[model samples]
Target: MALLDFLRQKEFAEISALKNKLALLEKDIEIFREREDRLNHDILSLRNERDKLLKYKDVSDVDNEKERIIKELKDAKEELQKEELESKDNIEKLKKEAEELLEEIENKKKQVVELDNTILLQDYGMYSPVYDFADSEMYKDRLDAIRTEQKNMILYKTAATCSTNWTLNGSEAQGRVMTNQNIKQILRCFNDECDMLISKVKFNNATAFIEKIRKSYDALNKMNSKNAVSISYEYLELKVQELQLAYEYAQKKQEEKEEQRRIREQMREEARLQKEIEEARKDIEKEQKHYMNALLKLDKQLGECDEVEKEVLLEKKSEIERHLSDLDIAIKDIDYREANKRAGYVYIISNIGSFGENVYKIGMTRRLDPMERVDELGDASVPFKFDVHAMIFSDDAPTLETALHHAFENKKVNMINGRREFFNVTLEEIEEVVKANYDKTVEFVQIPQAEQYRESQKILKSLEIS
Candidate 1:
């Protein structure tokens, strides 16, 4: 029984220890459950907070809320990406527009520059004549008539001078007097400006002067706006006409003087040619008589002489006959020249020192000796003697010259004046034109001698070396 009590006590001790371990485990499980409950509450509170932050409406549908939030975020991201692409496109478009605008501005700047440099009117020097008067005297008469009419208009208080009638001290007479004085002063100012511009007007600056006068009219009217005093448009037109007529009149006078000088030169040249032809005829006649007398003497000597002397006399007779034939031909040529006024030598010549290479003066002269005319041409007027390219005898020299001039009309050195017969053309070109127009085969001196010019150049070179 003692042994059974010991075993039972041991058993009771083991059961009591096991019961304590169970109580400790129960307390730990209770603490764990409380922790799990607190954790679950925290998770719920966090989920609620997350829903509020995400603006999720259904708290009970947590998974649906999460899915909806995720989908919304993806949609927002896609929208942001699309907007980013659009923004990039817009930036490129704006860049292109800005570049185009800058190019247009540059083009406008270039246009302004070009306009500033360009001439407003292309017909600068070739001004059209305003008056069709026969002479400068007629132009002067017209100008006098215009001036007299203008003066009469002003004196009679016509439309030439205008003004508004204003009351001065309530007297009509006083108002009239003031208006007259104002009109006079305005007329004087405008006339002075117009006269100044007209005086300065020329072929090149006519356009500028016209603009200035119109501007002056506008400015004077603006300045006298209160008085309403201004020059009439009819008077303005008359003034413009006067300016043009005056310039053209002066030009006409100059042209008339040149024409008169040319006429005098032509008369002198004609007189000289007559004298030369008469002298040449007389010389030929005298030479023919001398040759005839020599032939008669040789014929007498041939009748009396022996074989050797007879042969010499016959030879001398033949030479004398030949001489007489040449003299007769020269007399006939002189007679023809004197009879035919249009018969002359058309010469092509060049002065390389005066003009340049390929420049030729094609002219006609009725001189008995055409070389004399060429020599006269190469006289003191030119720096060097002219080299003759061709000297052609034409029945109607003027017509042939006119034909050549018409052929090379655009190749003239002085295009404005048809009288200046110098042409800038190649020898081949001139030959071609001459062959085409003239029936006769012409020989052209393709190479110029230019002897004096070449010598002068050599001298200059030597001087420079020294």
Candidate 2:
């Protein structure tokens, strides 16, 4: 039984061994199954890879795809390189443009500074040098000579002989005859001498030189005579006193003549106005008589006339009454004017300096002093005073004025306005018309005394030089 147990144990051991082997085989089979599953998955992955590889199995297709990828990558690389090169070139161009603009800005800044300096230089009188002659003896002598010559010229100019010409058989003698040409020549000479003196003086001395010349001129003028030359200042003073006395006497005589003339003119005007007033009264009386006669005739016819005839007579009577009333007013005005001695004057005056030649003002004034009226007209309305061509005292001055205006209607300066009594007629033409219309020999002064205007012009010219 023990032997049987040993054998059985051996058999059991074998069985156990077999069981262990079976277990090992089962674990190996599980492992092999898992590996088979993994192998199947790997086979599927390999088959997919093989299929994908099979698509490029043709060498030319594989080469074409590979080459296309490589060419795309190469083209992208080349484009990137080109872009990088172009970016580098753009950067360089921008840097160059920036540098040029900086240079241009610097140049414009320099020009602005230069312009400022130029303007500053000009304002300070650094453009040109002023002339100086203060240290030269020759220039001083020249200035002295100029001053003496200027003084002599002033003496000659202010001398009384300069006012009128001394003629010996229609030829001018050695007096300072102030014709326009002669005056212009004298001014030219004076200006030339002044320029010579001014040129020799320093800028600082210019004002003093002008002042001295002006003072010398005034002194010479004060010592000058109207009809004769004064040899020296002291002699001139005594002669001037004598001449002044004679001038006062002459002025008194002239005033007496004017007063006598005015008296004679007043007498004539009074007589003429009285006659006009008498004539006007006679006309008024005649008109009143006619109106009364007409009214009486109308009253006699009114009772026998038809309605229309009565109206006609009434209108005619009204018109005649109106005419008579007007005549009465006229007569009253004439009587008043005659009693008041308010005779009107028709004056012919011309300002040749202010209103060129051939322009004359024909105006009337009823002032007692007609010269006052003319002087008022010449006050400030014109730049110069007017010279009287004729002053006619008339009883019916408006009628005479109207006649003269009508005579020069074609020669009116302001043709559009009849009330503008200025005419472009010569003094001689006016004289002829006046002589033909009235029995009076009118004395007309053709020359204009533009002394103030000429002197003012000379002063203005000298001021311009200063």
Candidate 3:
């Protein structure tokens, strides 16, 4: 029995130990379960907060909201990309427009520059024509013609260069409207220059007239202006050529006129010489007839008269015979014919008050009475009446005149033309030359009978005193 009780006590101790271990395990289990419940609650709260923050009222709405938000973000990004592309295109368009505008501005500038250069070239080409001439009475008509032509040319050129239309009615019009202002200014300058040139063209002959025109035109050609005529070089050259041709024509016309005048003067001189020769021949024939008749009458008177009267008649007959011999010689020497004529008388005369001492006119006369020629010479042509120096008859009057002219050729007032008969010689010197040439005595009057001239001089002196 003792052995059985010891074994049971050991068993009871083992069972109590087992029950205490179980109780401890049960308490630990409760603690673990409480912790698990807290962890679960915290996790639910976090999930709810996440859904609300995502703009969803419930868990089912969370996924749809997320999808909508993501889609919205994607659409916004695409729209931003589209806007960026459009901005880039706009930038490119603006850049292109700016380049085009700049090119247009450059082209306009080039056109303006070109236009200015053209205007400058036009302004550089304005000019005028020239003329020249000489001064002389022979060119009087030619000078007048040239002056008229110059004026006409200037008017024409002015019109051409300025494009101004003029009429006799004092009306004006523009020819070309494009350059009207420039043309008007050019016309004003041209007219002013032409007026000045015309005023200065006071010439009496062709040469002087042409010279003045040439000088004036040269001055005009050198003139400059900001707005000048736009005449081409070819046109200007043609105008100058025309002007030269006109000048040449004027000169040729003047030369022809002078030649005609010279020919007329020569014809007149020849006619005068022939007429004088014929008259001289007739006078010689008349004198020969009268002397022969006187000789025959004197011979008959000598035979009928008494001794004293016969002697006087014989002397008269002898004188008549000598005159007849002289007449015969004169007639033969004259050898007058229709083809071969005789020369007349060579006369010397002077007007002392009008022409100083030693001044005499030696000339020929073909009149029947030589004194008639001297009287004719003393007419209204001279200031004073001429004094008769010598009236010398000669069969060869031209030869005698030539001899006298040669003797006083050195003393001639006009040396160029020997026809001018005035000579610086004394009356005594002329008488000696006449006596040496002719056998007959020549009567010379030393004093001038200036009746009209002296009276005029006296009147003039009284007027001066008054």
lDDT of 2 by residue, 50-130 (tens): 555556657664866665655554555455456555545655555565455555545433322111233334333221222
Model 3 residue 107 lDDT score: 40
Residue-level lDDT of model 1, residues 101-177, one tens digit each, is 55554543322211111353453765677778999999989988888877877877774444566889999889888
Q: Which candidate is the best by lDDT?
A: 1
lDDT of 1: 0.74
lDDT of 2 at 173: 49
Which candidate, 1 or 2, would have the higher TM-score against the true structure? 1
Top TM-score hit: 1
Per-residue lDDT value at 66 in model 2? 60
lDDT of each: 0.74, 0.60, 0.58
Q: Name every residue pair that clashes in candidate 3.
A: 131-214, 132-210, 132-211, 133-207, 133-208, 133-210, 133-211, 134-206, 134-207, 134-208
Please identify model 3 stretches exceeding 4 Å from their true place. Answer: 1-211, 222-224, 228-323, 336-374, 388-466
Model 3 residue 331 lDDT score: 60
For each predicted model, how many residue pairs clash, with residues at least 3 apart or on different chains? 0, 2, 10
